[model samples]
Target: MKYRSRTDIFASILQSANSNKGVGITTIMYKSFLSHYQLKKYLSIMLENDLIKLEEDEHLYRITEKGLRFLQLFSNINELIDTTKEYNV
Candidate 1:
């Protein structure tokens, strides 16, 4: 398997959370293919940046509007990169 960049990991986590109503940390880690330590580090950064919010009462995490925007932007960027590669540009 290839190594995933931090941005890729972040996008994966966001996508996972966005798909589920209230995703737990363990679920995100598994879906994102990240180790527990890596997940914790990324989760901390994401929470601090307001990309994801924690539902303390439910003990679950949910993606915020900012995270959705990031995901959309990331997808667009990836598409652009792929197109560039196809054209060898």
Candidate 2:
């Protein structure tokens, strides 16, 4: 597994948090395969950046508008890459 920094962590968090169903740390941790130490550090940074908001219950996280916008762009790039790869193969 690759070691990810705060920026990398935020990208995943932003993406996962976009859904209205909300997301949990465990899911993010699993999806990103982040270590406990890295998860805490980056989660705090994501909150500071306003990319995600913690639920009052402290069990769920939601994406902010800023995060959604970033995710939308990221998703577009990912789709484009997939399309290109498909054509190449």
Give the alpha carbon lDDT tens digit for every residue of 1-89 in model 2: 55655555677767667778788888888877777787778888778988888997768988898888877777787677654343533
Q: Kindly give the stretch of ten consecutive residues in candidate 2 with the minimal lDDT sum.
A: 80-89
Which ranges of candidate 2 are over 4 A from the true structure? 2-6, 75-89
lDDT top scorer = 1
Give Cα-based local distance difference scores for all models.
0.90, 0.76
